[model samples]
Target: MKGRRRWRGEHRRFAAVLVLYTLLLLLLVPYALDYGARRGRADEEPLLRRCPSLEEALSEWGWEQRPPLDEEEEEEDEAGTAGAAGNGSAGAAGKRHIYLHATWRTGSSFLGELFNQHPDVFYLYEPMWHLWQALYPGDALSLQGALRDMLRALFRCDFSVLRLYAAPPAPRDPLAPAPPAADNLTTASIFGWRTNKVICSPPLCPAAPRTRGEIGLVDGAACEEKCPPRALRELEAECRKYPVVVIKDVRLLELGALLPLLREPGLNLRVVQLFRDPRAVHNSRLKARQALLRESVQVLRSRHRAEPRGSPRHQQQHLLLPPGLLGGGRASQPQHRAEFFLGGALEVICQAWLRDLLLARRAPGWLRRRYTQLRYEDLVREPRAELRRLLRFAGLTVPPALEDFVLNMTRGAAYSSDRPFLISARDAREAVHAWRERLSRQQVRQVEAACGEAMSILAYPLSSGDAR
Candidate 1:
């Protein structure tokens, strides 16, 4: 009996050890996989070696002085077999890929439109938005991975790959009929502005009979007729042909997450980070809440009109009312949408601005050189000078057409945060400091208190009365 008892105890102990081992393996596997992937990428690409240091990289901008290249380095350069294939002017083909990274309410739309107006640029707006919706409420790491993968495919002009992760299965009520299967739609068609622009742009598609004012109302048939037989193939070909490909996304404030792409050899990427004053950002977000509320009301009204009364369609509309509508408490709604646009507008904007600025400052030298920081104030105040600086950073000569585009876009339009769609150069200088008149003293103080460190780093002065 004693021997049998001892055997049973040993068996229990072995089982416990095995269970613990399994749990530990589960815990560590993700980290291990991530590390391995990063290691593989580093091994495959050695673009960082060519940069040497941040100071040397910035020396090209005439920001600082550095020693000239040594005789050996010059010889290596002349032999046409020097550093990485994507280094300085020698490696820079006319082709470049640019990313404009910013947070919402930072005048990013205007900045994006600047690139969109460039004839040589194949500009994309917010391609990762669908991914965000599909992978609703994922953990930060998972979301980052999804975003990175989507961007990789996009920059490579592999549009079909997006369909794999673009739309997840929508939840259905057991009482109602099954939701419709999601179709494979091109990224441009998924976004309203992009859909209109793609249909109208002569290079991307043959122009339809649409006036500038009526461009946004283009029908599906018109777009389909103009689009190439294979949208993805044609887009990829265009990407190759264009001198520059620009992607503007406000969701890419976390600079650390994109370091790998900056170092990617094939991409030859550059970044323009746009920032606006926190007070202005906060005020703009508050104003935007009204716009969002109106949009939600419109959506509700449209649903009511489309669905028959008391039918499943109408019932589902009530049960799963869109987010920020009638205060429905659906987890999926919050998961898929930005809360900043709903409530606590000032707090969210201030915190995001501070966090993003800190993350950007911590980026390594090589990565930093690839980024050019532009203040909304500066860009609006001196459009031509800022445009020149931006083009220079991208290693492109300022063409007459580009200058004309800038002037035409901004020359006579009023500045309003609410009207991002309108391109106007009118009263641009006044918009820079308009926050002073728009925000209350208490509001400005609140913003300053939350973002004091970032404000200091960016050289934005605190108001005299609000100074701590």
Candidate 2:
């Protein structure tokens, strides 16, 4: 009887310990989950942060607070005096190339169409995107992710190309399934193309002798003519006159990879950074209504929340980025309409202002000097003056035709005014203060909260003459 009682007591004690351990784990599970989530997700903290910490910059408009950008006048002088850029007469041989660098919904398409007005510019519309999607599929990335990889891949590879929409030698189908063993980032046999001209690979074809320029999109030299003659002739003709080529598609925002082409000795390049009020941009996005807008909004929201003044380290440490940071999807809904128009719109404004503010604070002088900010409102208000400013910036003459084109377009007398030109009624009403009337009083506050840095950058004063 004594032995039996002792055994039962010991067993009960063990059971109690087991129960306690289980309960402890249960109690600790939420924290463990949070830790794991923080570790796993790059944007977990900002995702949780309410009212992004952007207010710190508000007191000084991010300009006063930031260190001044240093100029590289010497670098340009050295290049000019030392003949670093081909006897200091860049493109004197008539190799004119124009580049348009636009952020989303900033009237890029309209600008592209307008640029096409130049008798010389061919203005190819996003040719590289589809081909990029085809050539490199990775296991870790979605198909779209693979496309971005292909874009980055160009930096390491020969960049020569025919139609960027079609890969060299032609894949069986541009939209085929990604290859086996395809983790989203690794090259797959099907998606990966080997060419030393493109990157580190054996010769794509022996007859070609692996030249180190534009990556060929086909297997042979004769294939150079394979791209539609109309296209090539148009491009060549444009270069003959303007020497600079530009495609004003906001879609090409990731085109830093195209810098190699611009840097070549034969081309003189200027990139125009154009943008508009976010609500107008949101209106354009509204028209583009795509199902992916939800994801895009979530992404933009997170991006806006990240890198708040006090949290640069957090953003860098967490690797936080907007969805558009890597690439963009789309969104089309009333709320999303409101998101971009209202919420997403503020984020875009922040980005544009922040980019200019940051670049002014950090980039080299020539680049800073070379960069031009063309707000759509400025164009709308004074098209001739703005056009002249643009011409002067681009080192082009103030041609009568160009001036007339601007006059005609702004007067609502030219080229399909029926189609919205990426502006809201309010956008036409006021440049910075347009949001005041469009959004509800509460809605305005939400935007204010979201866009806490406005008073400093856009000259938006403190909210409410009285309400605060």
Candidate 3:
């Protein structure tokens, strides 16, 4: 009986020991993982480590706090400098190539449409869409080279560069399952090509092509029905007929990425960067969260892949580094996967914008002359004045019809929520402030936290926990 009692006592002690061990493991595992992560990141540069302070950036860029950007004065100054702005190595060519450098949901479509309406401009909407779709699941950084090459080719009116991403022909039936890969890319493969003025109008389509230079919207379905798929070579032929070529894309993240194309003597590239309030952008992104998931994942992928430590490439890429240390905690899965990724991508975008702001501030005279910045709020608030300035910058004159179109497009009936991605008319003011009503306080705070640096520089006021 004594032996049996001793055995029971020993069993209780063992159970107590096992419980203690399990509790110890539970406590230590998280710390162990965190320590490992910190050690791994020790060699990697923190995203903000290399970024200069706002004061430093502003000082180096030669600007005071919130200095007004008077375009007329700047233009006069640029004109006085002999070879500052418009003069490139290929200044003799007298051709203008404009890249609408913007990210998604920044009202870039509306801006691109302005150029598309101009008779002198041949516009392509997201030509890089083909590259992105063909190389889906590839990180954004890995595709920058191909994007640059493709842009160079497209600017020169060479369509063969697209052949690199060509896939099998699309199915004849509309309902047929799309080939597991992206649809075959031809002249028609460019995203939103159906609405492209040049593609939908004469010589390409029989649809009573709208009057030349008439500022109007194209019905995509009607255009698709009227216009048959043309060969890529034919598209190239059409591209060369215009004096100005404008391509709008959201894929190009960094301004520095375009430095090579900017320096090319054959293409006199002018960059117009568009920015929107980060909170508004974040709200719109959430509204279309699911659609943006894949791209967001691809963008966030770059942050995880560490470059060679202390290499020149590593140092160079820091400017474009997606947010590394800021908000770099493991994403919780309680929310939809898309929301998490979209939020993370927004952080990446803000970091990118901060870098661009710094780079532009310190850019040389020639580059400064070629670059222009536009805000969505400013564009909508004063469409006519802004449009005039934009046209002058592009070396084109604004027409009354274009002016009327801009006015009507921004003064629509309401901000339509059903078709978030549609490029239809809407009240621009309402659209700009929609975030105040839509985003929860928490959501606003999160975006503010992530984009605080860029917002401050751009003069965007932060929320006061009262964003109902």
TM-scores, all candidates, are 0.62, 0.50, 0.73
For model 3, what is the error of residue 117's alpha carbon versus the real structure, in angstroms, after optimal superposition? 1.0
- Candidate 3 lDDT score relative to the true structure: 0.75
For candidate 1, lDDT tens digit of each residue in 251-325? 442454566676665676778988888767766655555544322232222232222233344323222222344
Model 1, stretches more than 4 Å misplaced? Answer: 1-94, 138-142, 168-183, 191-199, 208-230, 290-364, 417-426, 465-468
Model 2, range 1-468, lDDT digits (tens) per residue? 999999999999999999999999998999899988878876533311332333332322332232222336334433442341334343333433455666555656545545544433324444344453444332111232333344333322223232343433434787976443212221211211221122111122234443322222224234232211122322233233333344443333222323334334433445676656544444444444453253344334434333454544433321222223223343443443434433443454454355444444444444454456677777767878987676555444445666676665555423223344432122333433444454445444444444455335544454583322
Question: Which 10 consecutive positions of candidate 3 have the poorest summed lDDT?
Answer: 317-326
- Worst 10-residue lDDT window, candidate 1: 55-64
Q: State the weakest 10-residue window (summed lDDT) of model 2.
A: 182-191
Candidate 2 Cα lDDT to native:
0.43
Q: Model 1, residue 293: displacement in angstroms?
A: 8.5
| Candidate 3: regions farther than 4 A off | 1-93, 169-185, 304-335
Sorted on TM-score, best first, the list reads: 3, 1, 2
TM-score of 1: 0.62
RMSD of each: 14.7, 16.0, 16.9
